[model samples]
Target: MRFGGFKRLRRFSTSRRLWVALVLLALLAAVLLLQQRSEPPDEDSGNGYAGLGEDAMEYAQAEPSHSLQFPGDHGPHPDYRIEWWYLTANLEDENGEPLGIQWTLFRQALASPDDEDDDSDSPWSTDQLWMAHAALSTPQDHWFDERFARGRPGPDQQGQAGVTTEPFSAWLDDWQLMSRDRDSGDLDSLSVTARGIDDDNTFGYRLDLTAEGPLVLHGVDGFSQKTADGQGSFYYSQPFYRVEGQVEIDGEMRNVSGRAWLDREWSSQIMGPAQQGWDWFSLHLADGYKLMAFRLRGGGEDGGDYLSGSWISPDGNVTNLDDDAIELIPTEHSEIEDREIPTQWRLRLPGQDLDVTVKARHPDRWLDTVFPYWEGDVTVEGSHSGIGFLEMTGY
Candidate 1:
């Protein structure tokens, strides 16, 4: 992700006020988990595309998805309301000291707020936008970055977001995840480069990643339902990356090598109005299995949040997790950026008879950038002693 500074004026204008109003409205709309509240008289309440009424009629009303094709699957699904390519890594330098890294690109379709049919201009005119965040952390310090862009659909103009297979490149300008060969679509030899400049500092990185394991998909046939009513998304991951790269802190280059995980998911409507944020984890277990889990936390007790995960066996078999199957409880909270974040967690998997305690490798891994959050390297003990990445967003 890239971070840039725009020139600022001392005065406010009518247009600025309107922009502020739009942002507030969007935030309010997100907080209204539609599941628990009664729909308006004119609204459609079914789980199918028909329930979305004429607004989103173009989307197919098919049953939960099952088949997923690769190469093509790595690209965008514009019809979806949201999509992202998230990567995290747990690594150690030559000294064996631990370090962690994260890079993610998020796409949010602004036009389909409630799946209502609202005809605007060109499909490119649709209000879709993109945002990205990247971070790096060591026991002694933490570094973070954030970037935002507008989305376009066609090739003449670089869509603010895209993923290509021919040369195996995926990126959104200066900030990108691309193949080094520029000819081979092999991801094992690809390079991930991202740069960001902020008032406090300027940071960037370019890393070479080689896959150590196979790619894993979550849920049944690629459709991962996140809510009780079957609201869900398509999700998959590549979690066995052996990375050797360099990160530029301020103006110095530091060589680093580590393990990395990449996650990609897309959905037309994933979260209900009540859902506010999420706590996500990607652990690289010492026992050979990798664990990926997330909890969608809705507001208050009246509405229920959702949880799902994948348990990757050493040999690369992926087991999908149901809502009732996984649990992550906050054992302690630390104040960062004037916000309380759970720094320690108790993770439980009932069916596998697994229970583990995870603690931050250090508490200061919090990224204090736009869309600030705590996403850093962590260590898991109890049932298994291993290293992993923890990501807590929206809170």
Candidate 2:
């Protein structure tokens, strides 16, 4: 569930949800542009609005000045056409074996908000389509699954899937990420549960998460610009959760405890066609500092590249970084699932005197999801050593 450059945790919902939304929007663009309202715009020749292209005027766009309100904003923003809630964690078993977990819920508005109000005549009427993906990873193996459904916004709405911030819950089928403390406005404490089966095995997790720090806003108070062209998303993260619970794989339960990261982002146009894909990183350093960074390929002048990141101090101060402030270079690649992927990376933050090599825990952490991508636990070595997660997409 990585949106190419978004590199999940905060990116899974963005990437996975946007994948479906863009595919659907692309189909719409194909039909509308081929019809050529006024002889097809040069930017949109019906190739689908991969990044909304020149036909983005039809849907609501994510502008920088938009305020992200409290719990309400934690739920669905159906007006935007696409949104997601993504959760990722780095857990350790009783024996101290590293584990990785992910759960994501994506909402793709089948029709614009204005249309949903008039188009749905019944609770079953489909205005918003939802998709979810869940996965669990051991040091040597990975398992995952995906599900889909249709929904409409209303108090009467009920299904295997939905999101409500009142009590703060996001779910699809039996997989859920919800709040444990209802009276609180912030997501201070929460519980996550999910069970999935992929052809040969059954996997799931039941975990308790408690926030140890405040929410970290990414890119100028949640407006994370993706490309140099300024297309981006409303992104924020609670990357300081302490987790404890049980993870079940193949029906075997293992008690686990570790740290987790929760990312919330929503946007209409998160990328442009020129921006091919991305390599994203979320590192939880041993000293309490956190880093979220990415490399968006091909959005520069003449289709070059763009880079950016956020540095969070132990006390929760965020230092927004531009392309020049940080460097993320792929140091090695591996052939996995028949795709060439960067299995290792060299991250350098000179100002902080931080230089490290982050490598995947294993190469086979390939999620055979609707939009398949690589997601796994990573080990950081060099200036500051720790563990984190890596999400690479579009390759």
Best by TM-score: 2
Please give the CA lDDT of all the candidate structures.
0.68, 0.78
TM-score of each: 0.79, 0.87
lDDT of 2 at 250: 90
| Per-residue lDDT of 391 in model 2 | 81
Q: What residue pairs are clashing in model 2?
A: 1-12, 3-15, 8-12, 26-48, 160-173
CA displacement after TM-score superposition, residue 152 of candidate 1 (Å): 3.1
**Candidate 2, residue 113: lDDT:** 52
Candidate 2 regions with alpha-carbon error over 4 angstroms? 1-55, 116-118, 122-124, 153-158
For candidate 2, the TM-score is 0.87
Worst 10 residues of 1 by lDDT: 46-55
Residue-level lDDT of model 2, residues 1-395, one tens digit each, is 24322222222345447545645554465346435533545653321123333334456888788777887788877777667888899999999899999988887655565442443465545656787888899888888877666675554336767888778888887788888987654688999998877766889999999999998889977889877888788999999999999999898999999999988888766666565567788899999999999887767656667888899998899999888878888889999877899999999999889999999999888775655678888999999998899887777
Q: After superposition, how far is residue 57 of candidate 1 from its true place, in Å?
A: 7.7
Each model's total of backbone clashes: 6, 5
Query: Model 1 clash tally?
Result: 6
